[model samples]
Target: MSPEYAIEGAFSIKSDVYGFGVLMIEIVTGKKNRFFTHPDHNLNLLGHTWKSYNEDRLSELIDASILESSDQDEVFRVIAIGLLCVQQYPEDRPTMSSVMKMLTSNITLPRPKQPGFFTERKLEEADTSHSMLCLSSSNHSITTLAPR
Candidate 1:
């Protein structure tokens, strides 16, 4: 959920935009944000992606299985658009039309600010801990929620 809807019980089209952004990032990463984990950090995929961008290590965010086959530039472009869609404030996120333009055009995009709902904590607390996990396809997926 977007921070507003998750924390404040607020709802708006921006919230949908946030979900859209999450979907984009999820698609690009080939991983779900909710069950994301990293052995070296306690960030969910969202936090990790933001950190990766700020650290000039965004390339590390790509799923290895697809990295070799996908155009790096296009992948990064989509990541950029995804980040823009999940900006912290609802007013800061793009409209659906804006997203379409972003996907279809080569317009220079503004730097995306921090995404909403960023949280950092150990993966041991993942909500899926008590549930059975069924991993497959190069062991890259989980079937439970793991919000930050």
Candidate 2:
């Protein structure tokens, strides 16, 4: 789930864009976004990818099998596009059409900002606080469904 959907109850075309980004990252890395792990950091796949990209270690983010078979530059471009779709704010993320252009053309892609839901701990904290606020309020049974 995108951070805005989980934390702020906001959903839009941008949310689908975020989901697409996560899917692309999973395909490129051969790892599930929810289960990604690195011994050296607490970041999720998106956070790790962003860090790797910034540190010039993006090649390390790809799956070994993909690395052996795929063109490195193309893989990097896909990863960059994925990161672009998952930026923290909807406004920061590219439109789907823009993403397509970036993927298909040689146009220069903008650098990605930090991704939504970058750390599990931060999400947990937000959920905890929200639960506490709910409990303290008079209305304790209200539930709302987020639009998919």
Model 2 Cα lDDT, one tens digit per residue, 36-147: 7677876878888888989999888999999999999999999999998998899899999998899889999888888888774455654576577657877556577667
**Strongest candidate by TM-score:** 1
Give lDDT: candidate 1, residue 57.
Answer: 82
Can you list the residue pairs that collide in candidate 2? none
Q: Estimate each model's TM-score.
A: 0.82, 0.79
Name the lDDT value of residue 126 in candidate 1. Answer: 80
lDDT of 1 by residue, 1-148 (tens): 8888877778988898999999999988888887887888878889988998888786888888768898888789889899998888999999999999999988998999988777787656685552444333375665776655
Supply the global lDDT for candidate 2: 0.86
List of clashing residue pairs for candidate 1: 34-146
Candidate 1: lDDT of 138? 73
Model 1 bad stretches (over 4 Å) = 127-148
